[model samples]
Target: MNLSVGITLAAIMTIACYSYLWRENTLYRIAEHLFVGLGAGYSIAMGWNNVKTNAINPLLNDGQYILIVPLLLGALLFTRFLPGSNKWLARIPMAFLVGTGIALSARAAVLAEFVQQIRATIIPLNSVNNILIVVGTIGVLAYFFFSSKFTEGIPGLKYGALVGRYVMMAAFGAAFGNGVMGRISLLISRLQFIFGSWLGLM
Candidate 1:
C-alpha cells in the first residue's frame, strides 16, 4: 500500500470536513453527500459479504438447511419496495428485527447503565471528593422536595430548599464553564496546528 496516497486522502477528507466552518455551499454539500453515500455503500457491501461467506456459500456446499431461515427473513425485508401485493411480507423480518433489538437493549440496560449508576452513587463519603459528591447529591435532592414550601414560618424547610437551589445553580454554572473550556481547547488545538505545524512558527 502507498502511505503517501493514504496521507493525501486523509488530508483531503480533513479539509472537506473543516470547510463547513466557512459556510454551507456546493463543496460542503458534495462532501456531505459523498460521506453518506460512502457510508451506506460500505455497509451494504459488508453485509452482503457476511451473508455470502456465512450463509450462501456454506449452505450451497455443506451448511445446514436451517440457514435458509435468515436468508428468507432478509428477503422479506426487501418486500417493503413492493406496493400492494407483497408489503405485508416485510413485517416478518421487521418484527424479528424489533424483537431482537429490544431484547438486546433490555439485557444491556439493567447491567450497564442502571446498575453501574447506582453503584457509582453508593460510595462512602469519608474522603474530601466523596464528601463533596455526597453534599451535592443531598442538596440537589432537597431542592426537589416539594413539601418544603417557601413560607416564612417554616424556617428549616425554606433553608433546605435554598441550599438545594444554590447547589443546582452552581452545578449548572460549572457545567457551562466546562463546555466553554472544551470549545476554547479545541480552538487552541486547531490554531496550534495551523500556526505551529502548517506555518512552522513554533
Candidate 2:
C-alpha cells in the first residue's frame, strides 16, 4: 500500500527506457516490451471490468433484460475464435463498432473542427485581433482554393493567398513549438522524478 516497490520498479524502468537515447540495447528492448505488455494487459482488464460493471451486473442484479441484446452482440465478437463459417459472425459486431465509432467521431469533429471554427471567426472586426482573425481565415482559404489556374485575372486574390501562406506557416510553426515545449516539459518532470524522488538529490 505504501508503493515503495512500485517507485523502485518505475525508477529502474525509466532508466532502462532512457538508455535508448545513447543506443539500443537489451535493457531498452526489455523495457519496451515490458511497457507494451503491461499496457495490453491493463487494457484487457479494463475492457472486462467495463463489461461486467455495465452489462453483466445490471443484467444479473437489476434484472435488466434489455441488456441481453448488447451482451449477445458482444459475445458474437468471440465467434472469430471458433472454427469454420462461425468466424463471419464476428464481422457483425465489428461492423457495428466501426460504423458507430465513425458516426460519433465525424459528428464531434464537424462541430469541433468546422462549425466551432467558423463560429469563432465570426466575431466583429472592431478590434485588431478580430480583424486579423477574419483576414487570416479568409486568406488561408484563398491560399488553398485560389492557387489554381482558373483564378487567373483575379486581382488581389493572389496577394491574399500569399498572405495566407505566411499565416499558415506561422500557425504551423506555433503548433510545432507548442508540441516541442510539451515534450520538453515531460522530460523535465521525468528528470525531476529521477533526481529528486529516486536519488533524494533535491
Candidate 3:
C-alpha cells in the first residue's frame, strides 16, 4: 500500500517537473519549490547530525575540550545574520573555510592535474597512439599560449595550435553530447517508472 502511494507520488512529481516542457505553469512552480525546500531541509538535518556526532557528542561525553574551538568557529558562521559591523564575525570562519578548502583542493589538484598529466604524457612514443597522445597534448598547450610570438611566429607551433583548437572543440562537443545523453537517460528512467511502477504498463 505504501509502495503504491510512493510510486504514485513520484509519478506525479515527475510529470509536474516535466510540465515545463509545455510551458511554465503552477504545477512546475509547486514542484520546483517543493524540491528546493526538501533539499534545504535535508542539508540542515545532515549538518546538525554532523555537528552533534563529531563535535557536540564527543565534547560532552568524552570531555574533549578541543572540539569547542571548531564549535565556536561554526557558531561564528551564524553571525552573518547580525547587523552592520557585527556581521563581519562571519568573515572569520568564512576565511578559514575558504583557505582550508583551497589549500586541500590545490594539493589534490596538483597531483591529479599536473603530476598525473605529466606522467601520462611522458610515456614512450613507440606506437602511433602514443605519438598522437603526445602531439595532441603539445597542440592543446600551444593553443592556450595566448602570445602570438609562440603560437604564430613559431612555424611548428602555429600548426600545433591549430590542432589544439580542433582538439578543444572535439572535447567540448563530446562533453555536450554526454550531458544530453544523461538527460535522456533520466527521462527514460522516469518514463519507465511512470509506466511500469505506476501504471503497470510494461
- Candidate 1, residue 122: Cα displacement in angstroms equals 2.2
- Residue 95 in candidate 1 has what lDDT? 95
lDDT of 2 by residue, 1-202 (tens): 2248877788889999989999999999999999999999999999999999999999999999999999999999999999888899999999999999999999899989989989999999799999999999899888877446425766778888888999999999999999999999988998888887877777
Which residue pairs does candidate 1 place in steric collision?
none
Better of 2 and 3 by lDDT: 3
| lDDT agreement with native, every candidate | 0.79, 0.90, 0.91
The superposed Cα distance between candidate 3 and the true structure at residue 132, in angstroms, equals 2.5
Per-model TM-score on C-alpha atoms: 0.64, 0.83, 0.90
Better of 1 and 3 by lDDT: 3
**Better structure of 1 and 3 per TM-score:** 3
lDDT of 3 at 10: 85
Candidate 2 yields a Cα-based lDDT of: 0.90
Clashing pairs in 2: none
How far does residue 53 in candidate 1 sit from its true spot (Å)?
Answer: 2.3
Error of 3 at 174 (Å): 1.0
Top candidate, metric TM-score: 3
